[model samples]
Target: MVQKIGAQYLAKRFADQLMASPEPREEPEEVVRETTEVSGDLDGQIFHDEEGQPIGRAYLVRQVEVYVVSPTRAGAREELVRCLNEPDSRVYLREVDGRLSGVVYTPDPARTGERTGAMRADDV
Candidate 1:
């Protein structure tokens, strides 16, 4: 139901999904290779710890598999996910220049079960 987000992802179009590993897990060679091989969705993210060291699962965006390391979320990540489930609220992971960038919080468009204007036009 990705299209429920108002966009289609080919239903079966392959997208990479990574798992969140504990901060102590460190980066594995296989995990590193997997992230570098494909770029798409990531179930987890990689960020640097307070000590200026990398933590979490490293992932990539659209293509090229360019590595981009981000900083720690300072405990905000869990909160973001929780609030996304609230009424009319949406949380998005923003990517820029094919790297993990920041997060975007916005109000979701209310779904009325009616076709959008573009759909109506196509029906006419």
Candidate 2:
């Protein structure tokens, strides 16, 4: 029997694929700032690509939607909060309608405290 995968699992798989692929090209800092919209302060700062361009999704810390594969919503929320507080952890944010609507914790090489990249929430 094929086991159904939850949203969190799928998201993690997607993130793993992105991490395995070649790093994205970097653009000028000014251009990145103008194109990207971020609203939260991560514990370890935002990530950046090899050329110094930021990598990963953007979102407001106040409205991060956590998707934990838990049986209860409260459990999921607790997991989300825990993930957010992790030191140097990279939480990928998903934006919606110009605001942050979702977030997923994933492993990324660009989580080195440098903010770069112009990422649209819908893209995720």
Candidate 3:
């Protein structure tokens, strides 16, 4: 039987990818939010298809929101945007048994509706 998954699990998955990267040094300042939880019903399916065969499926049991900002770097948000754009710079998901679950990428802040005005907190 398939075991159930949760938001916290997906959050950790997102966090792990950020930490294990070379460019983005692992910092404790990262944050994760439980954006949404989607069940794998008939209408709910995430997969990649090549030709007529199915390459893999992403069991999106949960949708996790992540925020990573580093004070050491200038325009850290832009850096993240570039990193996430690279195909190699991706976050892959794994099941409890350590099997390849899916690949995830940090969404662009502008597209994801996370970015607001350019004014910094200290500028306020």
Candidate 4:
């Protein structure tokens, strides 16, 4: 049987692979911010799409940065965008070794988010 690895290691490895090459940065998706628009007495009126076309209901968006991470050469890519007035250092991260990779949101305000398993020599 193969040995199992931990997220700390995988996350670090993934981060390193992406950061190693800074060129050809892909475009990041914009974040959407939803707000209620009153047409008459409606407080929770339905929202529209980015094109102002009615989509039944919609909301929210952000950032001007694309921080990408992929597990395989052809694996799915996840990106994090920089919120307004947010630092570019803000990056997307995944530490779990599950079949599907999802961004692991952290409330840690500190920029320590960047230091993952492989991100630090000590983590290795």
Candidate 1 ranges beyond 4 A from true positions: 1-88, 111-124
Identify the superior model by TM-score, candidate 1 or candidate 4: 1
Q: Model 3, 50-73: lDDT tens per residue?
A: 666655555543434334343335
In candidate 1, where is summed lDDT lowest over 10 consecutive residues? 63-72
Model 3, stretches more than 4 Å misplaced?
Answer: 1-46, 49-53, 61-64, 70-81, 87-124
TM-score attained by model 1: 0.20
lDDT for each of the candidates?
0.49, 0.61, 0.54, 0.45
Winning model by lDDT: 2
Q: Cα RMSDs of all predictions?
A: 24.3, 25.0, 23.1, 21.8
Ten consecutive residues with minimal summed lDDT in candidate 3?
63-72
Q: Is candidate 1 or candidate 3 better by lDDT?
A: 3
TM-scores of the models, in the order given = 0.20, 0.23, 0.23, 0.18
lDDT tens per residue, model 4, 1-124: 1234576778889999988966786866985666444333433457677998866643322222223333333432322222323454334544345433433322234543554444667766
Clash count of each predicted structure: 0, 2, 0, 8
